[model samples]
Target chain A: MIMEKLKLNIKIFFEGAYLSYVGLFRWLSPSTYLATLIFSPLTQMLFFVLIGTYAQGTDKAYFYVIGNALMNAAMSGIYGVTMSIGGDRWDGTLPYLFGAPANRMTVFLGRAFMHILNGMIGVLTGLLWGWLLFHIDYSAANPWALLLTILVTTFSTSGLGLLMGCIGLITRNVMFVNNTVYFVLLVFSGANLDLATLPSWMRIVSNYLPLTRGIASARLIIAGHSLTEVLPLLIEEFGIGLFFALLGYSLFRWFEITAKKRGTLEVF
Target chain B: MSAIEVINLQREFQTTIGVFNRKKKIVPAVKGISFEIAGGELFGLLGPNGAGKTTSVKMLTTLLIPTGGTAKILGLDIVNDAEAVRPRIGFIFGGERGLYWRLNATDNLRYFASLYYLDPAVSKKRIPYLLEMVGLTDRADEKVEGYSRGMRQRLHIARALLHDPEVLFLDEPTMGLDPVGARELRQTVRNLQDEKKTILLTTHYMFEADALCQRVAVINKGEIVAMDTPSKLKDSVNDLSVVEIEVFGIPPETVEKIKTLSMVENVSVEDRDQLQLLLVHTSKGAEAIPLLISELNGLKLGKVTTREPTLEDAYVRLVGGE
Candidate 1:
């Protein structure tokens, strides 16, 4: 049964990647990419890289680029699921998904896996764009550990996305919910700046945040750290992913039946 | 065996806020409503908004957990054996939500078909057949987002029937379609009856119920107010048979006088013009028409129309309302 579920999850991943416009629109229209992913984090990252070159030193150039890379992946992971799921909630699309024959776990995992697939595409774009424009070197000596970092990063980010998706389900305000929560997480994530320079309390908060530990782990990958060196961070990052996935899966399962009983699915 | 049976079934929903804000207030959407829907029967639940028709359907379809009552499909408890019931049922809500907008009609069917564990060969073969069944064969390849309201409705119906479940629950099957589309959808529903799929059709449309349902339960305010065949419901109203007329020149006083006729039970002026009126239960409409014209004293009837007891009249009479 578990094997079959895993197989079904793969299919759902492909379905979400191929079926969702957020996944397919870029391929179909080509022009949709620049407006969606480009101006979003890519443009901001470029501006920050240029600013870091003039204001700070050469060290800050890599700092600006690596921070953008982590932020891009994090944003992809969080928004990929939240907005997609939020889109469903805004239009009350989750009910249609919930109305399917599969149980809640199947539905949540399938969609979450799909978001991971889409998020990878976004990660690819951010990495490639960063490399091309700023001539940044993303190559690592231990490519395997770097890949592992990206995997755990993807998990942690998508996990946060799952939690955000659940909030979208309950709040039914996709834009406000996504923007408000994403902005708050982005702040503590210190996605825009170096967290080492913050006050003691702020640094403490950033380092201990649900995504911070995971962000540090992902950054270790881009900077080409050994797996043994970052194993503890990897464990924490993977754990956060599992936590959000389980949290999201359970909460979504609960809200699903409620939506049906309350008849909110039809009203919207 | 009964297709659907509910015995004192109850469902309570608590509105809860964020993670720590688990305080809840229970709302009873279904108040222990009990009834049986027989197999191969096209049944209907008719009500206005918030009537609990959808709630009852969801519970029966295993989409909801009952709070205090028990509902069974083919003798299986919905809550305990929900997965079992879902396979035996085909469900559809009247909206564009179910089908993936970016995907073509075939893709949507294939997705839902896979969801039901339909074999790949069968999935590929059934797509066209379901599309043909809903009369969207030519439009099958087009993205559902581009489909018109009626076409999208047709595709949604195709998606519903893809699994070929024994019992089909359709909630407001034709809420937004144009008259032509509604008529087409009603026809498709009638054809489903011919196929002997036990169907529970809920709609605010009295005419749709009258035309399609073998047994209809009129639900209002989360309670079953009336239930029976359309004809039986009409009979329950104590229908004396009324004369309906639309005239351009008839005056209000004349309408009042028409009510005073020996056979006339009540005269109701319907349209803005006093001329368009309905004369109820005075004389059998056929015999009363000439008499009404005679009483008119050359008021010269403009548009005279008559009809047997209609579902609206029946509903109004039974519910003590309109």
Candidate 2:
């Protein structure tokens, strides 16, 4: 019986990923997909690279280009997870999901699977665009370390996304919160700037933000550092990610019960 | 054991009074109510909007926590044993909103099938069988966005049945369908009854309830005002007949004047284009028609007829003549 339940949970997890993929992109026409998934990220990367070139010459162009490219992944992770719940809520399916006999955590965490995968795709796409367009040097970078950085970064950002998604259960303006967090990651992730230049308090704040450690580690890997040198940052990033995932799971369960008590699951 | 046993179930909602100075007001949506349905019984909850019919269904289905009472579905406490109860029941709130518009009909069913933990081999056979039952076999591969309102409602039914649950709860299942669609859906419901599935249906349509339900509970203002088989409820008004006065451009004052008569039991209106059909229930049927006509004064009168009381008459009589 326990084995049967486990098998069911695994099936449900994949089913959730498929649903989120279809539901999240339902509004995207072919043209819209091109504009959103491809054209938009490329343009943003180019714009920031051009700005960096003008500000600090060709030498600094790689900094702004890589920074914005990594931010693309963060954006996808945050928005994708947020919309996983938000889409269900708007479609009037949240009540059905909540009322189903399935385990709530299993069902909800399943939704994160596709978004994290999509975040990985977004990161890789951005990186390729940088290498091709700006001609960034990849020969010196360790591919295995870079892969580890991407995985850790995706997990950490997705953790933050999961927590934000829980807040979506009670509030209608989830996009407002999602966009706020997205911008916070962009500004303080140490993606574009050297954290040493920031104020002491701001550096401390950046340490706790999603992608700070991972992005810093990514830069180290690209600068031809050894895996041992980057391992600590990647581990820290993974730990923070785990914390948010657990906290999000607990928050989700609490709000679900409160919604049952208040009869507010179908409100928004 | 009874399929459902509800005991003094109640629910209250808090609403803010003002935008600036928010003060919460606890308003009861479902007052303490109780009832029972035998296994495989086709039970109906009949009420107008805000009559607590849906609220009661929500609590019974474990979607909402009851504030004051308890309910058991298939011998499992809805609050304490919610997870156990969910697998045994299926529900559909009539509309197109609950479905994934981008997914095809088959995909939607398959998705929810997993949510209910149906075995893949079982769902593989069940999904197509349900689509055939709801008469959506031809359009099973089409995206839900392309389907009409009636088709979407049928798909909603198909989705609900993917797991083959023991008890089914349908809330206003035919609220916005055309006559043909509504009739077809009702036929499907009857088929489910033949399969001996315990069903709890809620609707505002009196004729629908009368035609389908074995027993119905009339709810108003969050309370059960009346409960019985349809025929028995209609028999309550056997001594009373309905006097329907057809008036052209009848003023509200005339309807009010007719209600003031001592013999008149109740008054309700139905619009027929330029004509207003006034159904007046009274102990004196034809005798009261003349008094009603005399009371209308200078209104343009159309054909006036008198008929035997129906379940609608009992409903209006019991619900204070909505």
Per-model DockQ: 0.41, 0.79
Docking class of 2: medium
Per-residue lDDT, model 1, residue A247, is 89
Model 2, stretches more than 4 Å misplaced? A26-28
Q: Estimate each model's TM-score.
A: 0.84, 0.97
Q: List the residue pairs that clash in candidate 2.
A: none
Query: lDDT for model 2, on a 0 to 1 scale?
Result: 0.86
**Which one is best on lDDT?**
2
Q: Write the per-residue lDDT of candidate 1 for residues B261-315, one digit (tens) a residue.
A: 8877556666645556654554376777888877777665666666676776666
Instruction: Write down the lDDT that model 1 would get.
Output: 0.71
Candidate 1's DockQ is 0.41
Candidate 2 per-residue lDDT over residues A92-153, each given as its tens digit: 88778887988888877877787677777777888888888888887778898888788888
lDDT of 2 by residue, B260-302 (tens): 8999989888999989898899999798877888888788888
